[model samples]
Target: MPVLRQITTCTEPSTVVIERRVRTRDRSVDYRLEVCRRHRWLASNWTGRRSAEGSGGRCGTVMDYRPYAQIVQSHADLWLRPLAANGPEDHDGDLAAALRAGFEFLTAHREPTGVAIALEHAARITEAIAAGALPLVEGQAQVLAALSAAETLDAGARGA
Candidate 1:
C-alpha cells in the first residue's frame, strides 16, 4: 500500500495544496501540487525579469524556461482528452490542474517580444477554468501542442 499525504497553505493572495503518494517499499514519490492564485490584479501584473531575446539579451542562447513548457508537455493530454470524451466539466479538477500549470509557466517566462499578452492569456484561462466557463475551443489542442513542441526544442538545444 502507498501512503498518502497532503498539505495546504493559504497565503494572502494565493493558496497551494500538494498531495503526494509515497510507496515506502519502492521509495518512490508521486506528487501533485495545485497552486490557486486568488489575486487577479497581482497575477495579471506580474512581470518576468528575463528578456525573451535569450539569456542576457543574447540570441541563440538556450536560456532556461520554467514550468509553462514543462506543464504543457506533462499535463496537456489531461486537459485535451477529457474535452473529447466527457467534456471538461466532468474533469474539473484535471482541467484546473492543466490550466494552473500553464498559468505558472506563462507567469514565469516572458514572451519572445517582451509582451505581456501571455500573462493576460494565462489570467483569462485561469479565470475561465475557475469559473467553469472555459469554452471547448477547437484550437486548444493546437496551442498545447505548440507549447509542448517548444519544450522539445528547448530540450534538444540544451542537449538533454
Candidate 2:
C-alpha cells in the first residue's frame, strides 16, 4: 500500500488539517498532529522583495504549475461533472470515477520515452469509458481510435 506523505484537507467549515503519518513507533516521532485556525505560520508575504517579473514566486519552476492547474481543474470539474455524472441514476458514481480514471490512465501512458503526468491534462478518461470504450495505454494512435469510438456513443446518450 502507498503511504501518504500528508493529508492536507479542508472541510465545509473551512478548517485545514495537516497530518503526517509515522511509519513506526519511536519516542522521537509523534503519530497524531492536529492544528486549528489558531495555528500560526510564519510566512512573510513581502511584496517589495519580488523581482520585476516575480521570479521569486517561481522558485520551483517546473513543479509550480500543478497547484495552479489543480485550482482550475477543480473548478472545471465541479461545473463539468454534473452533466456526465447525472446519467442513469444507477451509474452515477461510476461516471465520476471513470472520468478521473481516463485522465489517470492517460498520464500512465504518454507520448515520450519518459512518463510525465501533466496536471493540466484534462483527458476525459471516465467520459471515454462512460461513452463505452476502454483506454488502453498501448500507444497514442490506438488511444485516439478508442477515444473516437467513445465519442460516438457519448453523442447518442440521452442525458449525459
Candidate 3:
C-alpha cells in the first residue's frame, strides 16, 4: 500500500501539494502532485519540489482540476472532429474557438513540449487550409482570422 500526505498554506491559497510514497520490491518511490490555482495546471514530480517547474508559475487562485480538464477535453474534441472528418464547413466557429483556446493555453503555460506540439498542429492545419483540404463556410472568416492570430502569436513566442 502507498501512503498519501497533503500540505496546504493559507498564504498561497492557489497551491496544494500532495505527496505519495509506494514501496517497491527493491525500494520506495515518492511522487508529488501539485495543483496550481490560477492556471489550473497539474504538476507531477517523481523526485521532489525541484521537479515542479512544469506547472507554469506561481499565480492565480486555485480551481478544481476535473472541471477544467473536462472543459479543455471537450473543446479539443469539438475542434478536432471537424479536422478529422475534413468537415471544416460544418464546424468553422468551433474550430476557431478551439484554436483560440489552445493559443491562450500555450501562451499561459509556455511549456516547451506543449508549445512544440501546438506549433506542429498549427502548421498542419495551415497546410490543410492552404491545400483546400478544409473549406470555410458562410460567416467563417472568423476562422481564418483566428488561425492567423494564433500563428502570429506562436511565431512571436518562438522568436521567429
Which is the leading candidate under TM-score? 1
C-alpha TM-scores of all predictions: 0.24, 0.18, 0.22
Judging by TM-score, tell me the better candidate of 1 and 2: 1
lDDT of residue 131 for candidate 1: 66
What do the candidate models score in CA lDDT, each in turn? 0.34, 0.28, 0.37
How many clashes in each candidate?
1, 3, 2
RMSD of each: 16.8, 16.4, 15.0
Query: How do the residues 1-160 of candidate 3 rate in per-residue lDDT, one tens digit apiece?
Result: 1222122221233354443445556434344445456323333312233334444423321221222233223224433332233223344644434443444444565653443355345545655665677763312233333333433344344432
Clashing pairs in model 1, backbone N/Cα/C closer than 3 A: 68-105
The candidate with the higher lDDT, 1 or 3, is 3
Residue-level lDDT tens digits of model 1 in 11-36: 23224332334455653434333323
Best by lDDT: 3
Task: Tell how far residue 125 is off in model 2, in angstroms.
Answer: 11
TM-score of 2: 0.18
